[model samples]
Target: MAVAPLLVFMGAAFGLPAIAIATGAFTTSADAPGGVRWTLSNLTTSVHGAYLTALWGSVRLSALSALLATVLGVPLAQAVVTSGSRALRDAVMSASGVLANFGGVPLAFAFVATLGNAGVLTTRLHLAARGWSLYSFWGLVVVYLYFLLPLMVLTIAPALEGLRAGWREAARNNGATSWQFWRHVALPVLAPSLLGGYVLLFGSAFAAYATAAAMVGSSVPLLTSQIADALSGNVLVGQGNVALALSVDMVVVAGAVMAVYVPLQRRSARWLA
Candidate 1:
């Protein structure tokens, strides 16, 4: 009974909407006397042409952004974990928490103000002359990094903390060089956690909508943007079903990512346990 309210809230907020979308994805738009008929056309339509292109673009963007975030974030996390000052660690973690949640229109506006053609930095530094455009694919990557980097740091920080200092000390006692210790011991231990964090970052970038929409509109042709376009009647009159089908595709991708991540996370937990 204590969890009843929570269950009800979940059902209403997530379960109901998901059920609606799943049913709608398989429902036809034909005006029969009773209601819509079951059809697979929406799923077929969602996997071809512009929709396919958008899905592929989103996958590439998410993969690249997550890869960059992982490359940069792991070292930053290690530095924080090994820092001598508690104040600095606290400050960094606090700032990371704020930055990780800082996305959407406000973040988009901030990027525009700082990197757009008429932006202060652009105007002062003449970045346009350098062939820098803020409304392109690379620009979206920069914008995504704003949050993804911090999110990576936050995700991996706990895992870094979970690493035993004794392991490093034991490696040092055995005359293992820094590179050797990391390559053999430390990295193997952290591999699962690191991969889990990377997958989390990938999903974060994949599901992103507001920042992309606010920055590039439809110029970049991301899956989330295409889904929005379908639902908003911008692309076609009766594409709501198609939009639902695309959403299901996104869910499938997310499920596959988590399927891989859950085992890694469990392995990491076993190490910590």
Candidate 2:
């Protein structure tokens, strides 16, 4: 009886909305009045120029951010775990936690103040004299890394805490070098947490809106922005067509990430024990 209300809540709150959106995306108006008529046309139509470009950009940014996050995160996580005192580790961890949520419009504005044209760093370096541009794809990648790196640190830090020093000591006692120890022992144990963290990072990168919107200001489009544009004022004119299609695209991206994630998680569980 306790489970019944929970089931009903989940079904109505989550499942029902998902089904309604999925059905609405596929259905055309002709078949049943006030009912969605099923078709793949919406999805197909969303795969075009600006939409495609945004999709590609979002994916690329997400990949770069995830990679950067892993690189910066792992080291910081190790630092937090291996530190001497609980007080110091807690302080460092708390700082990273604050940064992990430091994205969206404020972050965008910060970057702009520092990295944009006529901005602090630009003038300091005289970058315009060097014929460099900071408003393109590379700029976006840098922005993503700022938000992503700290998140990676926070996510992997807990896993690092759970890992005991004995594993590495054992590997070294067996004459393993640092690289060999990490590859054979540490990585296997850390794989699940690292990969899970990357997924969260990637999803954040994928769904980012305010930062991208504020940073590039339409110079470079992103998937989330495109979706917003599609559904802006009137949801009906576009028939919510493009918006629906983009939602499906987002689902596909999430599904692809889960494909790798599920197996990685299983393998990590085995490695950790």
Which is the leading candidate under TM-score? 1
Residue lDDT tens for model 1, 1-273: 999999999999999999999998999765434569898988999999999999999999999999999999999989998988899889999999999999999999999999998999999999999999999999999999999999999999888898888988999999999999999998998899999999999999999999999999999989999999998989788788899999999999999999989999999989966
Q: 45-123 in candidate 2: lDDT tens per residue?
A: 7788778998998898898878887988798778778877899888877887788788888988888888789789999
| TM-score, per-candidate, Cα-based | 0.96, 0.85
Task: For each candidate in the order shown, give its overall lDDT on alpha carbons.
Answer: 0.93, 0.80
Against the true structure, candidate 2 has what lDDT? 0.80
Worst 10-residue lDDT window, candidate 2: 233-242
